[model samples]
Target: MEVLERLFNVALVVATLRTTAPILLVALGGSFTTKAGIFNIGLEGQMLVGAFFAVIGTIFTGSPWIGVLCGVAAALVLAFVFALLVVTFKANEVVVGLALNILAGGMTVSLLKAIFGTRGSIFGHGLVGLPVLRLPNARDLGWFGQMISGYTPLVYVAFILVPVLILFYNRSRLGLYIRVVGEKPEAAEALGISIARIRYVSSLLCGLLAGLAGAHLSLGYTTMFTENMSSGRGFMAVAILIFSNGDPLKILLGCLLFGFSDALSLRLQTFGISSYLVLAVPYLVALIALFALSYRARPRIIQETLASMGRALSVKPNAATDAEKAVTRG
Candidate 1:
């Protein structure tokens, strides 16, 4: 029983932190774009670009930090393209997002084939994943200390960033504009705000963070990159964003839940569990979290839907047409 207890404890703490890092990174990205009234469905694609660049950079530069920078830069460039298509050109956001993902996947594969003469995978002369930096005095404090130590810089960055974000959103003029654009675009437009500009910046910021998350995967967590390695973590990040009720503290909590599930899967793999079931832990936990989020979000969603429906039904035909026109512009 004592042995089982220790094993479970290890799984809980390690898995939680492991899973939290990725989701937290993506959630930060999601937060920026959503706050600017743009739904970024291309986070997965941005992450892919980041991962590809990170691996290539590490191979060439022989340094993990350079790899991380390359990854971030690549994702940032893609983000601008996404903004141009969706925000500046007024293209269908969903369609643009889907296309961006396809573009990233196709581009990465083509590059892999062209440069390495293989589409399966590639590795360089140097191994360049990020190092694990453990907290000082971690071992001396026993189990709790061990649990909190050995996180990557990105993990610490995520936690350290909350206050900065809160202040950015609350105290800055830019924050006010972002809120204006998201909450009431017309009001922002009336005040001479450029909605497109705000959205472009937001998308760029989101891309930057998503890239960091990708870099973390390639360098921080693993020393290698695999095709489609991001899997569906981008989408999972979206679920976490919703589950946290837009609260930073809650976001951390949500991230921990995911991290724990992933960690548990690892421990299970070390034991006797089938590989298939162990791999399922991350997605399964995300699904459960989303379900819980839906329960909490349902009332607000229903209210908004009903109110919109009522307004439509009660409006004069001309007014209803105008409303539709306004939605199109927005």
Candidate 2:
């Protein structure tokens, strides 16, 4: 009973971190695209493709680490496709992104069935999930061990990326160019910043990170890949990006919120609950956060609206007077 108590308490924290892992990575990826003036709704598809590739790679190479690399590379290709269509062909980004997501879902399902000869599922005789790093004699360290040292490699890597992205976004010249391009493409072009090149790079990097997020799910977190394994994580990332409003650090926190709810849902499942309800936890949190964010932004929006209305109303009298005088003269 003592052991059970400890495990339950500790599991929640671990689960929280686990939940945050994918969100953190994907949110950062979405940040990259949004910073470049692109709304990448394809993160879910990118993640799913990455997850599928990682599973296949793990099956072939028998190494999760190498599988992760392969997964990221696959995601990179998908990202490139998105950039090509939207940037080069001048395709509608919204349509292309949605289509890409559907394509990814279909492609993964097709490949899984074709390769594994399974329509809905694929499982190995035995599969090793991501390596978990634990502190030696961790119980001796008390809560400190639970707090700091016990986590998966991908979780640590995901957290490490937070500060790294912060530095890149704030301190780098390329970052400046990205911001400028997103804000004003004409201005960026005048400054000799290649908008297309910047967008392409950002898109590629976003896809790469989203792939990493997916790899975390397949190679590190689970044994196999199911259809649409990303399961709206990409969409959640989109909501997180909007809530964070381009702040990377805050975005990381937003991911954590989603992760916590995910952990809770899982814990509840250990009892007796509908799998569908368990799945809804993180998404429900995202929905609530989005609503709160919109509510907060409402005041600012109304202020802007009022100011615009005032300008239009104030302009009308003079314009009308000018027209009347012109009529009299005529």
Candidate 3:
């Protein structure tokens, strides 16, 4: 009972919100690419590059906001490269994305060593983290204040983007174009919509959001950049994208679920649980949730597959009958 009480508390909720921010940002970015029918797996690499650059920018400019711009800029460069290769050159997106991830990891570590002279991590007195936003008079509300106040600005931005993106996808012209391109590229092209341009825009948007997520991690979540500090949140964002089916509202829910498991893992560590077990909690929850979702959708998938096969078979018989009739007429 004590364990349950400790696990379920206002503090836990706050931590969950903090942890959810980065994942939410990245997932939201991935949603743009997903809507454009682009399968970008390089979100992890983009995020890592952003985090590293954000720290470097902060050290040089003495400002976290500048650091965020640096981070976004770096991610955008990477995103541009991704678009050039995958969209313009017709390269396989999966292969390019994986290569970029590898490149980002190695490049960050090498840069860390060369620039900062640090091997595994870089943190010192010169780093500037983001400021927390304290709501006026919210503290008077007790537990409510704890839940609603004292978060970095990016956290608020991440949550606010949910509704903003939903509106964009549902009501905006560009959003409709992205959806049309993804669903029917040929038709979009026939309508004079440039598929390549839409894809490039989507990729860049993904990079921008990924950059923000990384900046939040280094500047807000913690004022340091460890080697590979993104810690698979990019991939987690991809998973969230898949689980949410690119819906902004469902994406928010998925991020919260992941954040809750992550926060719960940290909380469990304080209760004398095995560190390994606690560390595995978030991934385990993700896997179980994915499995459950797949299982629930299995019947529908099978039905669709069977229907397609039946249609194919029906087409062949009709073709044979037509051929036979033509021969008889001749």
Candidate 4:
């Protein structure tokens, strides 16, 4: 009972929310590109660049807000480059995205050396992180307070973006245009909607969102910048985007699921499990969940084929065809 209670503690819930914020932001960003019929695989790279620049910005300006802006600006630059390559030049999106990821990583590291004279990590003195919002008298509210209070401003923003995105996708004209372009490019072009322009805008929006996630990582969660600090959360966001299939509400649920897994992994470490195993727990759960989701969404043909195979293996072959039996009798 105690173990179970500990596993489901209020602190765990708070941790889950914290973990979800960055993933939610990035997933929301990825949704734009996903819906625009483009795959932006460089989210991880965009996030890294944002995280590094965010730290630099904070150190120079002594303001977390400026850091956030810098992060967004950095991401936008990369997004523009991506747009120029994949949308304008018609380069292979997958290849360009992978190359961008590599470039982001290398560039950030090199910039870190030049700017801070450090390789792996840099911490600024008096570095300020994003301020947390606390509900007044939250303790009296019990579970609700524990679950909702004391989060950074970005948490609230991320949650709010879900409904906003839903409205944007369903009600807004631009959203409709994006969908039309994505679903039927030739039709959209016939209507005189520039497919390349739409794609560019989508990529830019994705980059901006990714930048916010990176800002939260470097300035909201931690006051230091580390090499590859965005880690795989950006990739996880991409996975969430895939799972949600561009539905903003579904993206929220996916973020929560991944966030809960992350929080659980941290909680398990307190039970004296190997740190390495604990570190792998969230990813392991993610992999299993992704596999389960894929299995559940198996194509009708595949399921029918498997069912036919099972029937074939379970029962004997037809004793004889009707024509064969009649001929034998004759």
Candidate 5:
């Protein structure tokens, strides 16, 4: 009973919010690309590059906001490269993304060694972490205050983006265009919408959000840059995108589910569970959620596949009839 109480307290909620912020930000960014028919597998690299630059900027500029800008800028540059390669050069996005992830890992480590002179992690006196926001008089509200207050500004930004994105997708012209481009590129192109332009825009947006996520990780979540500090949150964001199918509301729910598992894992560590088992909690939960989602959708997927096959078979006879009619006319 005590363990259950400990596991389900206000503190767990706070922890979940913190843990979810980075993943939520990345997922939100990926949602744009997903909606535009682009599968960006390079979120991990973008995030890692952003995290390194964020720390570097904070240490050099003495401001966390500048750090965030640096991080975003770096990630944007990478995103542009991704766009160029995939959109213009006709490179495979998945391969390019994977290469970038590897590059980011190696590049960051090299930069860490070259610039900071100490690695494996980098932290010192001059690094300025992002400030936390404390709502005025919120502490007086008991558990509600604890849940809502004391988060960094980025955390608030991450959550606020959910509704904003939902409105964008449902009510905005550009959003409609993106969806059209993703679902029916041929039709969009026929309507004079530039597929490449929409895709580039979506990729950049993904990079921007991913940059913010990385900045939050280094500046708000922790004031240090450890090697590979992103810790697969980028890939996790991709999973969320797949699970939610780019819907902002569903993305939020997925983030919360993963976040809750993460928090619970930490809480469980206090009960003397194996660290390895506890660490697996989030991924384990993710697999189960994915399996359940797949299982639930299996019937629909099979029906769609069979229906498409039926259409294809029907088209063959119709094509033959049309050819025969043309011969008869001739």
Candidate 6:
């Protein structure tokens, strides 16, 4: 009991915030594409590209902020290509997104080899990581301060954007335009809204948010770039967006859930569990959540299936009891 309590402490909550920040940010970005009626699956690749560029930019400029800008810029360029292909040329979104992910994976590795004469990963001097927020009176605040402060700027920004985005998603003209464009392209067209333009904007915003996510992964705590470091986080974000249906509050809750799972998984590893099982815990939770969401989406089929299963499992009551109960009710 003591062990379990220690494992699930304030520190775990703090770690969850850091663990969830990247995916949460990426989900927000992906939500835009979802709302705009675009099926974007290239978030992983965009994030990978962003991570690489962020490292490179920091290496050259010795400024993490410059790295962030470069990361976003690189993601925007890729996003434009994606928008052009999918929006203008009428390419399949899933195919384009998958292709982009593959391209990013290959390209980042090749660039690493060419630029640093190394393969797989890169790290060293001049690659300034994003700075942690040091509270002015941390000691005075005690344990709560430890949990609340000391995260990177991006962490705070990601959380702050939740309310801001919720407001924008419901109230802003552009948000409404994107929704109309996605849900009813014909109506949007009749109202003089350009479907292609709205989609392009959506893609761009997704890329921008993805880039921030990638940058945070690479620079939030360490100035290092690893191959395939995103490790399916983009897919997780997509799944979350699907489950939430672009609802900001739901997305936030989903991020917290996934993030807590991830953090807990890591904590459990210290208790002598198998490393593989520990790693799979969070992914398994995500898969289950996604399955549940998909099932819920098909309520009629699920209800019928459950009813059939219940009937099959149920045993018949005694015939005498049934007769007596019926006669008593009458």
Instruction: Assess every candidate by TM-score.
Output: 0.85, 0.92, 0.93, 0.89, 0.92, 0.89
Candidate 6 lDDT over 48-166, as tens digits, reads: 89888999999999999999999988888888899999999999999999999999999999999999999878989667899989888886888888887999999998999899989
Candidate 2 clash figure, as a count: 0
Predict model 3's lDDT versus the native.
0.94
Worst 10 residues of 3 by lDDT: 116-125
Clashing pairs in 2: none
Which segments of candidate 6 are over 4 A away from where they belong? 302-330
Better of 1 and 5 by TM-score: 5
> Which residue runs does candidate 1 get wrong by more than 4 Å?
2-6, 243-247, 298-330
Residue-pair clashes per candidate: 7, 0, 0, 0, 0, 0
- Which candidate gets the maximum TM-score versus the true structure? 3
Regarding lDDT, does 1 or 2 come out ahead? 2
Tens digit per residue, CA lDDT, model 2, 7-114: 468668877887789878888988889999998888888998989888777778788887888889999999999999999999998899999999998998889878
Full candidate order by lDDT, most accurate first:
3, 5, 6, 4, 2, 1
Candidate 3 differs from the real structure by a C-alpha RMSD in angstroms, to one decimal, of 2.7
Q: Judged by lDDT against the true structure, how good is candidate 2?
A: 0.85
- Residue 238, candidate 2: C-alpha displacement in angstroms: 0.7
Evaluation by lDDT, superior candidate among 4 and 5: 5
**Alpha-carbon deviation at 122 in model 5, angstroms:** 0.8
Query: How close to the true structure is residue 19 of candidate 3, measured as C-alpha lDDT?
Result: 99
Residue-wise C-alpha lDDT for candidate 1, range 188-297, written one tens digit per residue? 99999999889888888888988998888887777677778887877777776655534566667777777777777877877788999999998998887778778988
**Candidates 1 and 5 compared by lDDT, better number:** 5
Model 4: per-residue lDDT, tens digit, 1-330?
988987987788889989889889999999999999988888998888888888888888999999899999999999999989998899998899889999999999999899778799888566789998898999899898788888888889999999999999899988888888888999999999998888888999999999999999998877788999987987888788777887899999999998998888888988999999988977887798799788887896698899999888666445346567889899
Q: What C-alpha lDDT do the candidate models reach, one value each?
A: 0.81, 0.85, 0.94, 0.88, 0.94, 0.90
Cα error, candidate 4, residue 322 (Å): 29
Candidate 5 wrong stretches, greater than 4 Å: 304-330
